[model samples]
Target: MSILYVDHEINNLNSFKATFRRDAEIYLAESTEEGLKILGENKIDVIFADHQMPDMTGLEFLTLASNQYPSSIRVLLTGNAYTDEFKRAAGKGYFHSYVNKPWDEQQLRKLMISNLR
Candidate 1:
């Protein structure tokens, strides 16, 4: 499965790539625009976006993505424990799930594997 990860921090992006590179085809983007571009060009199966981006919030990007590519599973990653925001997004059908910034690698891997299936 192909997965796209969008984050402003290079290190975070790098870490994600390193963590999941062996598991799937990984695409990395540093901005929403870049992520959108990648989405347009690739058949992404899943997408994970950092919530606190500089230009657009991850939910905003995921909302656009949901309209453009509804089949791709969306996931939000946030540093803050904003359950209300996460719940609202999920209720709106913008994202399938939300992950904390310092996420458990095993749980995330499992989530990705299950969603891809």
Candidate 2:
């Protein structure tokens, strides 16, 4: 399965690519527009986005992506503590999961594997 990861910080994208490169086909996007383009061109199974992007909030990006690619699982990664609104949005189906920044690689891998099945 393929996965798409979006982050304005190129370093973050590179790090994720390095970490998961062997596990799956990884596509990295530096902007929301690029992320959308990648999604349009690819058969992505999951999307992981940073919540504090410069151009758009993770929720906004996830919401748009979810609408266009309804079956692709979405995840939001944020350093900030979870808020009530985030909980509400997630409850409403904006994203499948919310992960803290400095994520546990093993857990994420397990989640991805489970979703792929």
Candidate 3:
């Protein structure tokens, strides 16, 4: 499956590629605009986005993506402790799941596999 990860941090994007490159076809973007462009050019099966970004929140990006690519599963990666915001976004059906920053790789892999199935 093809997965897209959107984050402003270069290190996080690199680390995600290192971790998941063997598992799936991974695409990385540093901004929501770049991510949207990638989405337009590719058939992404899953999307993982950081909650906080310079231009827009991950939720906003995901909301836009969900509107355009309803088949792609969306996930939020957040380091913050704000469960309320996460819950609100999830409740609105913007994303399928939220993974805390510094996430467990195994758990994330499992989640992705299950969703893909």
TM-scores, all candidates, are 0.95, 0.95, 0.95
Error of 3 at 106 (Å): 0.6
Query: Measured by TM-score, how close is model 1 to the native structure?
Result: 0.95
Worst 10 residues of 1 by lDDT: 80-89
Model 1, range 61-89, lDDT digits (tens) per residue? Answer: 99999999999999999998877867887
Query: Cα lDDT for residue 11, model 1?
Result: 92
- Local error of candidate 2 at 28, Å? 0.1
Please report, as a residue range, the 10-residue window in candidate 2 with the lowest summed lDDT.
102-111
TM-score of 2: 0.95
C-alpha lDDT of all candidate models, in order: 0.93, 0.91, 0.93
**What lDDT would candidate 3 get against the real structure?**
0.93
**What is the C-alpha lDDT profile of model 3 across 54-108, one tens digit per residue?**
9999999999998999999999998987678778878888899989988889989
Q: List where candidate 1 sits over 4 angstroms from the true fold.
A: none
Q: Give a tens-digit lDDT track for model 2, residues 29-70.
A: 998889999999999999999999888898899999888998
Rank by lDDT (best first): 3, 1, 2
